[model samples]
Target: MEFDPALFIDLFARTFTFWWVILPAIFLGLIVGAIPGFSAANTIIILLPMTLAMDPEVGLIFMVALYASSRMGAGIPAILVNIPGTAGAAATPLDGYPMTKQGRGQQALAISFVSSVFGGLLATIITLLAMPWLSQVAFYLHSVEMIVIMLFGISLIATIAARDTLKGLIAGFFGLMIGYIGADVVYETPRGTFGFLELYDKVPLIPALVGLFAVSEAFFVIEGESILSKRGKEAMQKAGWAATIEGVKIALSKWWHIIWTSMIGLVIGVVPGAGAAIAAFVAYQQSRAFSKTPELYGTGHVEGLIAPESANNGVTSGTLVPLLVIGIPGGATAAIMLVVLQYHGVTMGPDLFMESPELAYGPFAAMAVTYFIMIFTILPLARYMSRITVVSTIYMSPIIISFTLVGAFVPRQYMFDMYLALVFGVIGYVARKTGYHTAAILIGVILGPLLETYFLRALKMSEGDIMVIFSKDLANVLWVGLVISLCIPYAMQRWRAWKAAA
Candidate 1:
């Protein structure tokens, strides 16, 4: 449990010796993450044969670098084109797209890249310091507590209500119902599938996400010659290397915000069932709550862009915690790491460090080395990547629609998923035309099932008692925190109004 400064210092130095092995994986991750359908998990799965062939240390280094870098890459499309390359980057478009719309795309990209590196590096430090005891955090919150955490994320809808709370709530609840379309967990009873065989299973999220953000945005973009207007075009042309330097300056100024928001991702990610989506939303909500200019949030604030992006990468390290220390993978990506490590003859659990310190600490070393490599590799691309905004929508639209639809089908390989994506694209278009908040709806879609599953499990454990959620001290504390977080924003708004009147 003791922190060994010299030991970690040596490990850090040793990881850089593999820079030749690490660099190619970083570029691979950047490409995989930038493409809408290609997830790190899927890439890892596809490369399993090659990975298995490598020495375990080489394999883990390649996978870890890819995993960390991919988290940063997902933000690029979200900022420039309003398409989230990964589910975790869903929140990125809220402000990142807006920044792009205003010709700040290069800065947004820089901010995103820097924040991701900061978050991932800080999370590695946190993991190093707390890995001995923090893995137990998964046990502190049960299904009941997770339900509250889910609520904390969904409550972001209120913060993003824009001009109309009614429309936002409607959009959010509608997405929540859509999330429930699959068969019920308790019984095998189907709910809203309407007799489609595909509906018997859950609606696949990749297609839904692709349809909702990428496809729908493309549809709207096609209404004009370009995705940007004259002013936005002017901004895009103005994007340059200076913009990249400005972005680093902005990120450095908000260093504290990046640190704290990333810590939120780390803490939430340590819980077995929580992942980047939850961490990003919660960080965004908290960022808005504490902001002096909270009203500027959804309208393309830098804080808004950094909060979610920082949290997104912070999750990379926290995800490794439960896997290495507790033998529980937090999500599918972690599960792949777990499988690969196990296949390579690495053991998990408390004594892992004792049995094989090299294997135990190899991932952290890879991640730390990855952040160093990503800075040099990705930061310079901001100027070039930002230029995508100037491309004619006529060309961009068809490509986005075609490729994302392909991405949608990649996960399940069903023609039905392609159809489902078209359906959601129509729905997303309607939501966009209305005063409704699409981000609100998307977050709901992401969190709704987790909320329902956990709630159901908690109830079943309590023999259907409604009060089971508040039974534990930890759960009670979360209940109180959720209530306060839900109320304070409204209370602050009212206080400001009253002060203005006085």
Candidate 2:
């Protein structure tokens, strides 16, 4: 666990020599990430044969670059078109799309890119230095502690519901009901599926995501000439590279926000099955909870965008920690990396660090390098990418539906998923028209099942004792933190109101 400046410096320089491999992968990752239903994990799987053909070091660097860049790419569409390329980017469009509607798409993209790169780079460095201790996070966070952590994310629903408690609660509970559609984990009986075989397994996330965000948004856009307002169109047309510069400045100004939010992702990523989605949501909730201007969150606040983008990208480094230190893959992407490493006859775990320190630490070093390269590579494209907003919705709506429908199909390749997406699309449109928050519903859909799984596991361990949640000291501490986090915004709001009255 001792930090070795010389060793890391050497690895960093060596990774730079693979810029040829890294550069192309970065571009490919952006494309893969921006497209709905595609992810670095599946894309890597599709290209496994090609990856396996390369040397282990080259392969790891390639995957690292692709993984980091893809995290950034998922934000681009989320910012411009209100389509989250992946679940991790789900919290992104809450603010990013609003910025686009106001003709600040270029600035938003710039902020997202900068926050992602720096946030990821910082986490990668921290992971390298603290890998020995950070790996222990997985072992310490048992089912009880994770339940509390899950609450941290699920609390976001209540936060979103703050403006109109009843409608938000209705939307959130509705999504939770939908999430429970599959067979109960403890028993084999289906809960809400209406006799469909596919429903017995579970409602697939990709179709649900694209349907609610992409397809639903596509439906609304057709009611206008463009996704932008008249003033927004004029501002966008007049925008130059200055907007990109403004974004970078904005992100840099919020350096403290990036640091803490990304740390949230790093800690969560160490726990197995706690993917970027949870990290992003928790970070956004915490950001809003602690902000002085909490009301500005969904209305295109820069911090709102930064919090999720930073946290999600920070997950890139944290996922590698358990993979290298404990022979456990933190996520699907890390699992694929494990296969490649095993193929190359490299054993993981602590021994790998001692026997082959280069391989053990090389990927993190490569990640740091990849993030450094990404800002320069993708930052210039924000100006051009933002222009998509000015396109006529007549053409754009069909294009979005076509691509999203295809994205819905790619994940499971079930014809049923496409139909399911349209169903959710109509549902989303109805909710939007009824003044309900789709993001609140989404938080429920994503976290409800996870909460149930952990809660059931805790209960099973405790012989169905409900108080088992309070059995762990770590769990108790997390509960206290969660309570404080949830209370702070309301307390702050009341304080401001009292001051105004005085």
Candidate 3:
């Protein structure tokens, strides 16, 4: 497909004309993304309803830009405080936290920002160039193929489940069960609601997600009172552009890791159901595998810092691929965008590309633009953002609780959501304390509906043949991939244990 200069010009015009809407969304996204527990997906859900009256193109561009920017924004806290604002930033803490302890906080923050911007911009280019081809591929995916892809995504849970595989599986199974609480897609029969009117719609995505990620994170924050301590003013003062440039130089030295991880991110992001967390983890593992001293990976290695940060940011554009091309959400953030698109009466799918290339390409172009903007905007503000690390838990607890409650209740205005958030907060704390991953459970929640719906539909479609899923070549390949993904982590853990014993 040839580049359409007219379309590019039109998108550029729209973005320039709607700078007011775009800038505010970008700013809000950055702020929310920087805040621990306020994830990009949740922020999109919170703000999507408000964007209903705006032009579809404007709203799409604004939200997509915000989504891309938030991935970078979350890195600030992850580097400074060791508390990842989002699961995607989890790998940042591996290296970034150590850098903070070593008084390289400014350097760490700078590296994260610069690498993130580079990864994002490069991924945007990949997205723009690949969308036409990807759209063509997406058109050929049948239900069986989609089911296989989702299974491949769900298998990632085993790898991320970490040491407590059983506990992680339990958490994931519980999440899947929770996802089934609403009406059945095929028969419209209520499953787990026990006749509660609210249950009829199934658990709302915003409330459940708020409960799982945000509320759970809040509880964890309160439990760990270290968040209340103040950093020395000297450390705060060290945040500046000079430090960032040094970090960028360090990151540039490890350019190969950045390129490969970003490529991994693009591929994963293109697959529906795989999100930023998986991308970060895969990049971290791959970086470790390729390191000259793998032992240094979790010990503040610069490559460790660069790989996952770049990869996570790279996913920002990748997630948009399926969303714009096939109408299927590649991740939770994209799911929220799906709602926004539906609200605007613009159906997502091949038709979206065929009909409204402006709406499709405008957001893609804006994402590239936002990356450039963030480098300029966030570099100068690193010191201010890093200061958030010093805010004491005593002072932060109430504010966090307030936002958690408000964010939870804002979606449905229901008190039940508040309770749900509190309950999930406790759950998250327990999971974290026990080494079971909240990310795995959240993935379950995100993919559960799709898994159940497709699995059941495939069964029904096959007239109880039960072998239809495996009968497909794509399904077989995905199943094999799932087995490998699950086994690798277990194999690695066993090898580590054995080596330690030796």
Candidate 4:
């Protein structure tokens, strides 16, 4: 019942003692993060069982380190190749690629790394401080309110659809429909499984994530001899330690920039459903609006690069707040972490801290140590990392596909998963070729069941009255917030257009 300084000290001491575990994960993350399409979530899913096998502390530390660096690694391709490794890094290229074109590719990479470390570190501390206050939020948000929160995340699908709401919504709903494949929770009747026993359970997440993100991306990666642009090749040749040092100076000098943008990431990350992609874009937009030199933003600016990188990594910490404090995963990566925790029999939420302090606090502590390791590890390798773009895709593609396909078979050890992965890969490839958003579909598959489960629980408690969603006071408040958020943007856009016409 009392705060024991020794326990807190022991947790960090234990984490620090696991240097062997933390260091490898950071580098592993860097490798995957640099390659477009190899998201950390899929990688973790592929290797989920291995993590499950390790001691809980070691397993969690490994995942935390990889997840954090994965966000950092994505910035590499965005700056060098004009292609973001993960959608979270999508905002990085707005200014990063221009810097690369200006022969400042290494500098951009350095700034990205510094911003990420600073944001991740600061957000981790903030999360540690805020955990107690934030945990109380879970008490008020029961199933009814949680359903609204799920909708809030689903709403982000439209924004990521990239000017194609119809396609995004279709993808989201389709994933949701697929989520109902297993037998209904209330009754024993299978909802959508044509006949297979596999359908009697549920769709395996690992195969679905790998097939859609990793395998589909490999198909695209092979189309090129190299992943780099001609100019990117030139930039890589000249990068070295000096350039990385300069980046550290640039990022550290703008301490306020990193702090504020990272806070933006923290706020959005806490909200259910909003991931780094939204956080990065929001931070970028805010930075531009408040800039004294807004005109310089899209033209290879350090501040521009800093904002998004900081925010996305800040999101890394923010996502965990909900998962640890409320048992709700805020995004896909957080969901993967949830699976690992559940597999290991670690219950989340406030009580987790009291019951399993080591498990509850270990992830945050590991995050801090990881950032410490990342700064030194990634900085020296800026030169080496930049050169990766030059590696021919001929070599890279097969390695990526073969490894990921293997990963698809890891979770359940079922051949059905391999087939399922290929099917999702084809679907992902089609979605990529068309305008449909892969994230929307993935989110649908991941969160659809969660949403349905909560909705049904709320309805059942209220004797099947759909209006139960608005019965609770917190639910009413959430509904109001959701409606305003959905309507205000369209209304504001129309108002601006009308004024211009007048």
Per-prediction tally of clashes: 0, 0, 5, 0
Better model by TM-score: candidate 1 vs candidate 4: 1
Candidate 2 overall lDDT versus native: 0.88
Clashing pairs in 3: 182-202, 216-425, 227-393, 228-392, 228-393
Candidate 3 residue lDDT tens string, 436-475:
7665666566567777777887888899787888877867
Best by lDDT: 2
Give the per-residue lDDT digits (tens) of candidate 1, residues 1-502.
4677887888888889999889998999988898877898999999999998988888889999999988888999999999988888988988999888888889999999999999889988889888877788887778988887777666666455435655766777777888888888888788888899887777778888888888889998888887676898887787668899999999989999999999999988888767887788788878987899988987879999999999989988889888988799988888998898899888888788777776777788889889988898889989988888889997999999999999988877899999988998998898888767777777777777788899899999999998998788877887788677667667877998999999
Pairs in steric clash, model 1: none
Cα lDDT tens digits, model 4, 313-427, are 9999888888988889988888988988888888887788889888887888899999988898888777666665566778867776777677667556788888887898898
User: Candidate 2: worst 10 consecutive residues by lDDT?
Assistant: 157-166
TM, every model: 0.96, 0.94, 0.79, 0.72
Off by over 4 Å in 4: 1-21, 28-112, 221-225, 233-363, 393-396, 488-502
Q: Who wins the TM-score comparison?
A: 1
Error of 1 at 373 (Å): 0.8
Instruction: Put the candidates in TM-score order, highest first.
Output: 1, 2, 3, 4
Choose 1 or 3, whichever is better by TM-score: 1
Which structure is stronger by TM-score: 2 or 3? 2
Candidate 2 on 1-502: residue-level lDDT in tens?
A: 5688998889899989999999999999999999988989989999999999999989999998888888999999999999988888988988899899999999999999999999999999999988989999899888898888777656565565336655766787777778878987888788788899998877888888888888899998888999888888888989999999999999999999999999999998888789898888888878986899888998999999999999999998999998988889988899999999899999999998888778899999889999999999889999999989988998999999999999999978899999999998988888778878777777678767777788989999999999999999999998998787667657867999999999
Better of 1 and 2 by TM-score: 1
Return the lDDT, model 2, position 459. 97
